[model samples]
Target: MTALTERTEVRPSSPSARSPLGFAGLIVLLVLTTLFVIGLAVSFGSVRIPVGDVWAIVVNRMLPGVFDVWWSQARESIVVGSRLPRALTAATVGAALALSGAVAQLVTRNPLADPYLLGVSSGAGFGVVIVTVLGFGAGMLGVFTVPVAAFVGAMVPLFLSLAIGGRYPQPTAIILVGVALAQVFSALITFSLLVLADERQLGSVMHWLAGGFGDARWSTMIFPVSALATVGTAMLWSARRIDVLQTGDDGAAALGMNVPRFRIVHLLGVSLLAGAAVSVAGGIGFIGLLVPHLAGYVVGIRAARLLPVAALLGAVAMVGADTAARSISSSLEVPVGVVTALVGAPLFVWMLQRRYRRAER
Candidate 1:
């Protein structure tokens, strides 16, 4: 645990480093791009709304009596009632997952690591299945049951990993423990879905496991958005610590960091973000794996520079994927997770191959 002898830091390209002004410009571009993607997502549903009208509808809703009643009630309903919440939820969940992923990779020093590398997704799925199949939390928490169950379930893996890792927890120990727990939780979810879940519950369970913002509402956005704001701010505040930790345990110790304690706190934060995202979006994958790597490529891997870009890039990717999921077929909505997996798998391979090439050089 004291030695980082096995770990190798992933260096960023020199040319990718950002000046403050250039970084600000990049942030602006990504923010605008995310907004554009959200607008597209709002416009692409069953009844297509133009982008201009989408913004207009949003403005009217926010500042009532300001704009005339030009747009139809039905159009407003579609935008406000359905797509707006869904799109915003997608963005929030994306940002949460991406930020969680960044922190996970940073703490673990594993390039391929993701938010769910700690088993949070599996735990969340198991929780959802337990509630949906067994009706365990039906009356206890009301509409809040699933999310609360999910948050609790997600904590299971964290506690287990910590217990198994003992006092001086190392990145490798956490990864191995997480993988084991993830598999166990995944198996439980499968058994529950297959044996306990009835025909009626199957559709929703499958949709949720595959991940989509189909059920997203203004009400559902509360937890994830709040978690992202809190956890994201904490991560930004600890940017210097992240930079130190990235230099490995030896370097972190020299900088007076309590490496194990720092890792533990980071894991807890990751679980919260991951749980919030999973509770709302239901096991959305690949954003965590893909976005940080993409963000690193653009911003040169400093946590300070990398985090915001990763978040915005994630939002853009998620909204774009959600839009595609909605627009793919007139008859059915595709799972946004499925879309992300389809894109993420190949892109990840390319990333791996690119890394190998760089290593060879």
Candidate 2:
């Protein structure tokens, strides 16, 4: 466990292993793969839509309402009205979470850094449970209720973390607080689940905690997708700063960045992104924790290159997970969170073993 917090010296001085054009090409390829995965996800469900008709419906919807398409309204409704938005939501949540995780790792300088690691997801989940326990339920805020509560809950921890850590993540103070909050919130959620939710509500609440896209809607998807776009664009621009940030506070300050202020601001931005995602999706874990490591392996730790790769990987992983969750069992759909955990846990174990092997060498 101590290995999780051990600071690693990023190999920034190594000669660039990738050319700009090559990196751009790789990113484009990954983006295409992500799109393909989303398409694949959209093509299957309780009522499967043919791949060709899926595109036609999407095209007709994208164009003016007058555009003619041969597809049946039910098929069009299934794709346009149901699965497309869900797939888009999955993609957006994946990208935002992976982006937030990467940023969290760089800022905290901890290999275990993730949206949940900082209590953001737990906070947001607690918010949802609170609303649910009160009977405010899903429609309380209309479409915005859960997400709004989630974003608000998520921000509280970020603020408290900064206050406790004095806006610095060094020496593990923030980590400790985050862990404490995570435990506290987990307890609260469990209590709410056991005491507050009825048997009929149990499945929904559990699915929410375990993470599912079954209830995804375009209205609920818009805010997080907007946050991802805005914050993701800012993240791309801040790549150089991110590199500087990984160099330690004194080093970054020496290089003309305001260490304290920068940490606070970046934490706020990432919390917003993570919070929005958590609000829409439930306590989906590990995509954020695991994708950044995979991205770093593909493109070095430099944020510019890492962000896109992470986003693509995250998007594909999420959509793929969602697709599998729905299709794997005829009797019941697995939660997307469970799929991610099943995938990520083994990867995490492998990474730990590889880390130890490197240490022995």
Candidate 3:
């Protein structure tokens, strides 16, 4: 079927979904909820800290000019040194992934268009593998190199997917191409580990591939957060255009909107956000695939409504998932990706069956 026809299938009939007043209220609640979740996450670690102290530590950090430092060095070290950064990074990456996923699904006019579904994760993984195998840099510079390479790597699948789908937004064909690309990258990642990486390196490589926030530092939050802020703002500002596009390209052009220009810009924005998220967090999947669908139950399919809500929901899910990953076992910490997969897989299956059943009915 034509891209236009396919887009028409999910056309937004719930125009009220973008109601400013209603969403403003929801946004306030979500923002507060997200803060609470962050605090909760900070309170739990290998050594549990009180929630009250967690907030106090955050307060001191935020208003150092005002609040006197009273907390012990160890307490300060635990909070500022590790937990806070991981918690903050989790929120940023989750929001970026979910927002990108929401836009991706809209851009492709497909229900399942996500960074992982479209090979962006594999591509990012490929980048990480390249850096790890090549010994690109060392010390501080080396730490930075992986993220840079991963961002570049993430773009590979997006561009390839576009090229493969070539002058057409055939969602089915594009998805298939993306899957194939992902497999190629996944195999290459394994090969790199087997041939290049040593025994001691294997464990870290595996964790990075699966996704974890263990190495997070306050410095880690900088790049992905900046990318998310810029691209996310662009997306929110273009919400009306996205709504127009949902009715398909013809509708957008008839309304004097630049459909092609919008799609090109839109793809770039998604790539930047999704790519940065993958680079920072490794291959944490399903926030993109799952969060938008859940948020859609409240916000409808419009970009304006879905984007922000999905972001908040995604933050909550990721923070919670990360918490579980680290907390569940003192001896063997689970990968955050595995945690998300456990939750996302069943939900994804249910969504597919429900969508098809609804379509049939």
Task: Judging by lDDT, tell me the better candidate of 1 and 3.
Answer: 1
Misplaced by over 4 Å in model 3 are: 1-8, 17-21, 65-70, 138-140, 159-180
lDDT of each: 0.83, 0.79, 0.80
- Ordered from best to worst lDDT, the candidate numbers read 1, 3, 2
Worst 10 residues of 3 by lDDT: 1-10
338-358: candidate 2 lDDT, tens digit per residue: 989998999988987887899
Best by TM-score: 1
The true-versus-predicted C-alpha distance at residue 188 of model 1, in Å, is 0.8
Superposed model 1: Cα runs more than 4 Å off: 1-6, 12-21, 139-142
Give the candidates in order of TM-score, highest first.
1, 2, 3
Which residue pairs in candidate 2 have backbone atoms (N, alpha carbon, C) closer than 3 angstroms, thus clashing?
Answer: none
Candidate 1 or 2, higher lDDT? 1
lDDT of candidate 1 at residue 162, scale 0 to 100: 77
Model 3 over residues 1-361: C-alpha lDDT tens digits? 0122244258585757544559889899889999999998998877788888888887888887555666688988888888888999999999998988888788767776775655777888878777677566424365677777788888898788778854565445655666778888888888888988887667767788789888777776777899888998889888878888888778878999877667756766877787888887888888888899988878799887888999999999999999999888989889999999999989989988887898899
* TM-scores for the candidates: 0.93, 0.91, 0.89
